[model samples]
Target: MKLAENMLFKYGSGKVIRVLYINPFTSIIYVIDMDSNRWSYPIPKDDFLTAYQNKEMIEENDDIYCRAVPEEELNELEKQKRDQAWEIVTFFKSKLSDDEHMFISKYRQKAMKETMAVFSISYNGLKNILIKYFKGSQTKCSLIPSYFRSGARGKERKAGNKKRGRPRKNGENAGVNIDENIKKVFKIGLNRYYYNTRKNSLKTTYELILKDFFVKEVIDENGVKIPVLNNVKDLPTYEQFLYWFRKSLNDGKREIIKREGTRVYQQNYRAIIGSSTQDAELGPGTLFQIDSTIFDCHLVSSFNRDIIVSRPILFLIMDVYSRLIVGFNITFESLNSYSGAMVALANSMTSKKELCKKYGIEIEDNEFPFCVPNRILSDRGELVNGYINGSIQNLGIIIQQTPAYHADYKGIIEQAFNQTNIKILPFVDGAVIGGNSKRERGEGLDYRLKSSMTIEDFTKVIIKSILFHNNHHVLSDYILEESMIENNVEKIPIRLWEHGLKYKKGQLRILPEEVIKTSLLPSQSGLITPKGLSFKKMLYASKYALENNWFQMARIKGNWKVKVCYNPTDLTDVLVFDEHGDGPFKFSLLEHLSMYSGKGESEIEQIKNFERELERTGKERELQEKMKLFTEIEDIVKEAREKTEAEKNYSKSNSRRLKGIKENQKNERLLHREKAKKEREMEVILDESIEEEDEFAMFRDWEESNDDE
Candidate 1:
């Protein structure tokens, strides 16, 4: 590929504004700022090509070729430059206004003079230096009095002047320009034929790259020359090897590398920079991030703190822009989409007043907003996918899901969780995060000995952490020129939110309370039986459902399939949607023999087992056997929740493991109570029949004695 001056190419940030310089060699290109100004330091051809994405083009030598600079980007860059120029003319010009001080034009001349003198070049170099001085961030340094940029440039220019012409290193001068080599070799290792997942580290690949050049020619028996490894001292230094090895790793960005396909990088490595919610569609109520993180602490059952339950999962929704926690749930329950999706969905729409109250955190009015975000960024959990996604979309809120296993996409909330770990969890009595240091410096710290924190206690800490993040955490704009905040405004998250809400109101949305509340509840399809509704292997018939003739009128399909919404937190009542006059009416259900909230889905399975057992035995025998079965179930769950979390059983998946342990424990106290009630009824009926027989026998005996006499 032939290269020339005035041709545009991509540099570091996919920007084509950095035009090729007036002075360029076959292997090098000079950096240029907007307005076609160039730098003394020449970028190597390989480095220029590294950043190419093939989407941009530049006109050179009457041929249209792909350039780092795209035609469309040129227009945008110029517009941006024009805006910056206006800002400089308005705000920056005032700083130079005293009559005694040099005029702005004079300062520009001085800055340009310093640049040309430092590069050891002529008037040709003067234009490039002057252009960069006014256009780049260096302008800010220039505006500061007593900040002589010339003094700093003298050292750098001397270094560049001395190294101006050495044997052209592939995109770098004689210094270890090993980046190109390492990237090339590392990519080769990424191929399935060369890359071995079972054994390959960056260090291994680094050594391999050095080995490629660490060869000496040797005479073979046939008098033909063969390349063989030289002495150990002849090998490339490890420092250079490691430096280039690390350069090959461009976190989540492998625009120039081809090795990602050899191994599934997506599952093993999280890209540091990719599809983030932090900067995307940010506003007061436009982007909300939802994620489930297990708190870095061990918690016990609220009923008993001495017994270790498990580290609870924190299902939270954070407003991406405001850093305000909208809604969350803390439980020792495993990752149920019901807890994850609904809690976040409800949190986005409803007031945090009730949520704060539940956790005993007090809040003033408007401390947090109750408006729903127009778009939510969530992981591909069961809730934001499949059927639940369609259900939530009905409320007119768009759901944007993060690609599988990409935690960076939801970094805004992940950062919030990190704050909770660093600040709040440490003070809590039983946090495991203390042991996260290298070499397990906190190995012997038995947090469980101090495991006095309950799920509710941890919940309070989370609320405080959120309040601290929103009300006190300082936020800064990445690009100050385009910040939503004015120079005079505070940068706290809550303050930013207030400002953005008042000014940057981009598609802010809020659903009606009923609509949002219903949206938050999990929906399931159920068949309306004559006995009421059959769902999850249990028969549930509400007073409203039975009274409305849901079963009789449901003969359209032989049985009507009704949409059922139930609070996972409370299974005592389910809302069976009766679409009559006033939306879906609430329904009070007759309690099933077993399936309750505490049992979770285990109750459904237990009920099925109980039914099967009853079929094997008669009703009376079944009742007696269930009394024993229920007692055993309670014992099992009681034992699990009460088990102390010792070091031996501690795991990262503590919440899930404990849930499995508890599942084995099976809480069938409801089953036991029902069985006892039926037993008592049977005893009364048996006693009354016996008494009636005794009375009839006594009357017959008395009549026979009287006749004989």
Candidate 2:
């Protein structure tokens, strides 16, 4: 056995390439470029003849003779020596039978024995050399020998330059260059008997497990040295313990459970009694929910003022407990934000008395109980939301912004607006209710003012109508049936009282006469006389409602208009003036009567009859007026004379004939009376005379007596 020629090559500058292999049977070792996959000097026939061979190579107990035998040596000609040697020999014999084939046949057997090729050297040296060779050379074989290395290096350099430009200088010292890519290696071991044992199949060596390590040597049951191996599975059967353990070393958790797989339970949140709920006992003016809605009243637009027809905004404060709309404002413009809405809210929040004094509205104490409201609740409209989010605390009012889009949060106010706008406003034909769209009929001034009536006239109509609605329209609690049942009707009752209201009982408190009398003052005594104020040539009541420092609240012009309501307990009484210290006028009930005028014969006759009645009473002025009325009537009849003298004469003749017939009837009546008197006298004479005188004489005497009488 002997070592063959060895070479070290550098493809580019400062790059060492080594080829290494081991012939285990011959104890021969080959060292070459580590980067190149090829061995130096075609490996060797054996290590017994290398320049580096020593006593260690010759005294090895492993089969060194296998490399020493010429017949067992490998030929460098074939790429694969085991199966292709015979094929290579046959090909050479056929192609070169002349001189080349004969020369090859003579030394083929010797070359085959001389080359028992393999890789050898320390793992570090092998890796370093391989790195250097691959970094510089393209072909693994080119890094093995000088001849192949020179040719391959030229081609790679030229190609690389063409592709990537000329090579640039890298700062590395050639002789002692360190390859950073080199990885550490471990030694695999086997027992002598197992390593030398005969085998039918190729065995792959498995890396040492716990079995290879002997923490401390121990004697077996038979006093033999033995090592320990932990064979039991360390985890539950469901999991791969080793796999999870290895991952846990890197990930810190043995079991990686995704958050998506975990269930999260949420807590139930209920309004707390002393917190979200009211702590104080509810009373009148305890709570008010302020909000705005578009009222349904529609009006026509005046000519030339035809802006985009818009529904007016109606802002109102409703008593939550009572469901009463306490204070409200009707505007012909959209609210847009909290500016106007807050104005309405402030107005609604103040007591009617305070408000009247402040705003100069003549509202009374009774109205105070009706108008003053407490806490305000509202949905998250921009105005309500802004108030809640901004400066509500400064106003000293509790504001609760209803959850977005949840109508039930402010159900009471919402329902109040609905009932007020939808139910009541539609009845008035030309009412322009604020907070409603103007798209429908009867919405604007053009529709409302087109009538003969003025805005003031329409205001009167609106006040009367709205009063009727408020007094007569039955209000209901704004709560679901389920809530009602849960509270056992107590919640509704409390809420109603807080809003300053009560539902009507089915039975009336008194008889119809009493009801009417109590409802309205008597016509004569204690009558509220309307002071005359002329408008459009017609005298109307001034609505001097607030008097003696008293306030009277009433709806005027679709708004809450206040006046001083007064009454004087006397018929034909005049309203007193504090400034003059005297009565203003003889304002009586007659002022309230409906005014009318008439024409034609029927009207004239009525006047004549009225004057006659006055004359009988001996009213001097009335009597004079009656005489004047009669004279006027006679003149009118005389003025209706027939045309032409012949028609006049005919009328006169007809009148005379009628007169003659009347006189003739009267004369006949007188003659009949005389005849009746004569008959009575003759009867008495015949009784006295009796049987004497003949029948004929008696008959003649009777006839004569009748004639004479």
TM-scores, all models, native as reference:
0.41, 0.26
lDDT of 2: 0.36
- lDDT of every model, 2 decimals: 0.54, 0.36
- Residue pairs with backbone atoms closer than 3 Å in model 1 (clashes): 9-68, 10-68, 44-171, 57-67, 636-665, 637-665
Location of the lowest summed lDDT over 10 successive residues in candidate 1: 63-72
For model 2 the local lDDT of residue 369 reads: 32
Model 1 RMSD in angstroms: 26.1
**lDDT tens readout by residue for model 1, 231-283:** 65434455555543444343333422334552455455533333655444446
> Clashes in candidate 1: how many?
6
Each prediction's RMSD over C-alphas, in Å, is 26.1, 51.7
Candidate topping TM-score: 1
Per model, state how many residue pairs clash: 6, 56
